[model samples]
Target: MSARWRLAPGERAVWLTATTLFLLVTAAWLEHQITWYLAVDQFGYLTFAHDLLAGRVYHEWAPFQWLARTIPPRTDALAQAYVYDHGRLYCRYSPGFPILLASWIGLLGDDAAHYLNLTLFLVLLSVLIAVQWRLLRSRWRALAGTVPIVVLPTSVYLWALTPTREVAAHLSAFTGLFLLLRAGGRGLAPWRTAIAGVALGYAASVRPDAILYLVPATLLVAVHLRRRRSPFGVVARIGVVGAIGVVVGLLPALAYNWTATGNPFRSTQGMELDQFLAPLPRSEPTPAGGAVGYPSPGWHGGTTSDVQGGGLRLANLPRTLPANLAFLIEAYTPALLAAVVWGGVVALMVRPLVFVTAVPYGIVALLLYSCWPRPDPRYLIGVNLLLPMLLVEGTVGTLDLVRRLAWRGRVEAARRLAFVAAAGMVLALVGAFALRPSTSFGRLAVPILLIAAGGAGMAATWPSRRVVAIVAPLLALTLTGIAVARAWDGLDRRAGFQRPQMLRARDTFRRAVEPRAIVITTEDIGRPAENIEYYSGVAHALYLTDLARWHGSVFGVALLAIQAGVRPYLLLPVSDPERPKILKQLAGVFSLETVRDIPPAQAVEYFVAAPFHRGVHLLLERITWPGFEKEKQGGPPG
Candidate 1:
């Protein structure tokens, strides 16, 4: 028999813990995949990957050679990007996520991106849990760690599923923090310091906001080394090495930005956003037959009109802060909040180093992004992943304190009272959930009742140590289950990864219509349309608004599409009243023909705007396109 067949009890227990964690993390990954939602960020990242694969930095949506022939010149680069990049532009985002995604797509193909992200999530979760286990090993700590991974916050899971830098940022930030803490305990070896510095630098590459943690973390390392009475020469050398590692990590992002946008520091996205946000004169006539003026454009995709009004200004910060804070609070669930409190308490008592590990990143993130005119939690998902670690640490520390107290034979009666109080508190939490109150009085009464019950329960029970241990585990399980249920419920309500009906319609239309033609939407089709282009394998589709500043009409757009000698299909929702007006304008300009009619059942029925069939046939016959022969042979012409 193999010697591997024998195992000690402790070895078996370790394996068991690892196996259980693996299974739980796997389940969480599966749950997120089932939802399989894509958002604007996912769309942008995936499109960028596709463009890079196609041997281009930017995807050309439509020919802009004739842009000047039709529309008046505009000085705005943002407007120019809309006309040129065709809204398939990749801007306002760090390149790390997209570049990583591109590598995955190159290996497996487009459909593989989602699966690869799921795999990444598994690896990241495993690393985080392993690190936490090393730092604080206990039943409560394990359970607390499991809670965040199992029932991730809505923002957290969404970023995890999408190919965004947030996941990478989290991985690097937490890993760096963990390494620094380890170095703090066991003297900081040169290699450990260098590796930690690289990790932090890479984190900043993933998200600029990560610098908030990196700057402070670097300082902590230097201070710790100095306090250890290391030679000044050694300290300087360490600092130099770490700084070099950081610069090495940051080189790729800086080089790519410089090459692409001609500015190593920032992309045109913010400039474009500023132009879009600024109240500019309408170059085109409005529907009422005059140029439109605006304090802010009433468009959705560009920016938040409600808050910015006309432009992003200092005044808008205060107006948007409340909503942003609310979103952040909701995203950080009550379970997590309690854990943070407990973890903070514990960190204060036993592990001062732990507070600096993950908590600072979260605080910096909260303060940094609170001023954003747009309240998107996606940008700060790294912080979301870090705060939970603190909670786990706190809970573990508290449990360890209790265990120590019990072993010392001190506060026997006090320990019994504490258990009774804890039990009563758990029961009160259950009651609060059961009778979820709408009124202020009900909210006040529930907590008041819980406090009163805990005081009364402390005076009543004298449970044994074994009983307390069993009850605690049971409570952990119950709370974890509730957390998971709430996460699922929140996901269902938000529908982040949903829009099945719209996707079904897009797929149905692709199948029913011509396979090789240009699809242009009458209005600014948002993520649903972008989803079709990236995920639905419909690369030929381009939004009409993106083609030109049509300002409220699709006349110049149709003319341009016709001039390019491609079939121009105008897509509009069947229920849209604007469809009739658009069709009439197209008829007045060019011969209108129905290429296909998508039924309301399969899709929101839409019309295909094109020249009459006979006219198109004659036009093609007279054209004698040079590429026709190669197209017939399924190859590009030389």
Candidate 2:
């Protein structure tokens, strides 16, 4: 807004140095942690690429499609993140991401799918830096103020390792800010507004509820146009064009649902809402046999959920809101928490445009998820992009506050005490890390260092001093390195935890059946992960969730499979204590033998905040009823 906001020589040097460090750290993290195949919903996106490559518009992979049609257990079977309808398997997620991934897969082969996120990460970071510079008009604040990508470790994992759609969501958000700024004071550049609307719509394809990204952008445009003295007719036309752009962008998603699920409005997500949240009638079970749960085979009972009422209700706000916030705390970096607090002032109070959208959208996003039956922290990521910008303005706000305090000529002794306390804490941290790096506190120095350095550097930059300018980015990079190191440790820790389970699942799946055999697992365990159900069918690993609603009875379905002339190996988890009782339950339907005893995780983790691992052992079993081999020559090979 003024020439005083121009970057200084020292600040330029700091921005350059920090950017270089950030790139190196990012490259290292990608190299160290990235797996070859996408996980979770990204897995479904990957599989869709196959159909796209084959030139089919709506999942006409005849072989797999045929299996779903001809298969006997069709009534109770479908892949995760997908809906099975009349002999066809449709991925529930919109294909916006899959189209991007498919292009990479087609051009460079399958491994390129994993690198898409890395590609998007770089693009997203570049967008953040560029947008922050334009917003703050200073190179130095832009980098650190953009919020170190590692400031939220969960974000690192979510963006770098989760869905590329999420990275696109963040990119669109920051880009929207730039577009709106440029579009303001204009004589109705409806195209700019329309493009921004399109970006938001595409993101919502994957995150159906991510339409909240539009709230801020729309507010800014309407307010900007009205303030510019534009006619009501012109403003209304721009609004209509923006709305049209969203509908145009969503055309693919709408077409997909119509063709794949045979219902234009139905989504697997909506189906889950009914399955997981729909309540059973209190007096008598609803016609659909109550909300489905995968109860452990008759031997033992699983968690009887303590839900009083089912589905999303306003009454649950008191309980869900606190739970969602608690989950957020567990996932966030300390630096992010501080940014949210200090930077929040800028977002909510100082900037009318920022507050107009940020407050409403953030509140809506958080509240929407808070009412969810199981709100995962990643759901809030779209709105979380605003925090970094707010942090940039927050530094300016803080500087202004400091100048005002200095003008007031406050007590010198109080200032000295504050400086001494800060110095003492810095020394204590340095001493702990340097002297005994293996101590619990030292081992956890990264987040701790991040908390101290990132919080201090962002809150008080002392822009006039060259030493402080140099030190600010040095501190920022140090915080980045600390977060990277912390994240690296987490990545390694999860790999170690998951290795045993993944390898065991892989090995068990490979040998569970003969050349043409099918294995029905308690969960969908494919080549690498259960969550990646796209590969489960290709690997011949099925799960109970398919038939979970009808009745989660494993043997009930197992008998149905046998009657239909197909035998599926049952992969189950057995409690050593309940081993005999579980076996008795299985004996009732058909004689069974435990083929393999997969061991549990070997060691417990201590330092990591969330230790990802399998605590229970699993068993691979084969049914041994009479005439089990009579249909050996039938069905496709595993």
Candidate 3:
């Protein structure tokens, strides 16, 4: 009897539930408790979600906004009321992930959104694993295939958080790849092809770079068809499916561009230019010494260079790309590097198809990392997912080849040596697991058992049933256990209330100020920093620097927006170096008052200095220099 059949129904159900619960608990724990500091980009997402809950719609460049806007209304009266009154959402990211978040928030409220996101991520991850199992046709091999993904440190980090566009994009991309492989030369059933196409489209929508995958994927499909000497009908079907997917995926971005910027291809570049470009006025000479202006030119759009002759020039490519790559490597934990090397080595040796699929994605990831100014680790998360799948699949295929040779009696000695080597490798892996920074030595007992099971499977001397019996449950337990343990460790160390202090600060400022607060700050202090519109319940503007004399165009926009009553609260912080000039500019516009210095103990507290708020109130006080005094009843700086 099969092991699956031998297990009691209740026992099987309990096992399945335990595995699932382990994944869920681990994901929740990591997202909520992990000690790794949250990046500013995450705050940007939270702020965007928060703003979507409010009725403000000005910041619509992000694609995630559309998703947030489409959240379904709930039966709960309070949720319904909140949605009806304040849900004018807009986003710069693709609509897929935010839509998912909105749906969860609608169903269970904000408290459950993160957990729901983690659940969705795990479900998709399982689907990818199942796809590999189906392709390999061996349960043991499938389990091995999934191991790298579940245990990779960065993968663990991503699994335990809110859904990012990159996460959705990777899931969609993998699903599309799986469908394509399943449909190869069989000529996909119309509905299946359409569904696959839609999935691919969604992936592309999440990341424009995913568009590169469509061409390669289509060529791969076409190559398979040509090899079969299939009729023109096959070509037509593939073309139609590919075209439909690309168009569907690109539609949201196209529509957004048309509505916002009058060009279908105009991306966040236009919005950034309008909001963060446009030069700042020259700083008047200070009474103390030399005049202070904005620092060296800041980044615009995806380009990391300054605006030249009223447009951004891509001059910093030499300096930017390497820095971005270095940052990307640092952001991913060491496990990722190990996986990449492992995948590369295995791919070169066996299962070349897996290698082919991985290479294009890796190249694309590299290009984006190299060129893009932002060094966000999240951008490369998809690579983490792909490399592990390839590594495991390749390893299993190579082991299977060895087993075939041994069975044929052509290489018995070689097979024996291979088995011994594999056993030693497993022991080493167990030792590595024990040495892992987060894992407890005591908890590694199960992993050691799993390594032994893998060694038994590698030996291939026993009946296949005995091998399956020993290996299947052990592999499952290992994958499930690692996922659970990592999740638990992550949740145990979450920043909790301290992390949400920024949100609280924004709320406080909003309550204290009037409806239209003319907030002014450096460009970096905008959305991710203050999330002013979300927490403050006020319309605000960016202060951009003038490009010719200064590079802080976003800061100038803040001042201009304030002057135009688009902003009402003068929410300037104490960190602006040209605070006197900023104060002088504001003196002409409205009443200037130092409502509050964040640390309270410091005399000349600036907004920038607020982020440096460790236990250094004394240091801040020592460096505090009072310069900007409220111009008593003045209309302009004279």
Summing lDDT over every window of 10 consecutive residues in candidate 1, give the lowest-scoring window: 614-623
lDDT of every predicted structure (CA atoms):
0.50, 0.52, 0.46
lDDT of 3 by residue, 377-489 (tens): 55556666665555443333334445545566756664564465456445645555655333222343335334543644455454222334444555556656666766566
The numbered model that scores best in TM-score is: 2
**lDDT (Cα, tens digit) per residue for candidate 1, span 367-456:** 556544555556556666666666545433444455545556655654764565466446646745675333321322233334334432
lDDT of 3 at 608: 28
Clashing pairs in 1: 37-497, 339-391, 342-394, 343-394
Give per-residue CA lDDT, model 2, range 1-638, as digits (tens): 36545556776675676677676666566545554332335656776767778877545432243244334332323334444456566676777777777888889876456667777877777776776565444555566554445555334444565435777666656665566665222454888778767776776665566667777777877767867878878888888988887777666677777776667666444543553444433453111111011111121111132111234545445656887676544443333344455656654544566566556777788887765544444666655555555544443334433333444564243244234334534665665556533322433334444444444343244422233344334545555565556645554433232333434433545554543344554332222222223432423444454434334445654555565545556555565444465467677447777776655542111101112233446666776555444445564432
Ordering by lDDT:
2, 1, 3
lDDT score for residue 154 of model 3: 41
lDDT of 1 at 223: 52
Would you give me the overall lDDT of model 2?
0.52
TM match of model 3 to true structure: 0.66
Candidate 3 global lDDT: 0.46
Least lDDT summed over 10 consecutive residues: which range in candidate 2? Answer: 287-296
RMSD of each: 9.6, 8.0, 10.5
Model 1 accuracy (lDDT, Cα): 0.50
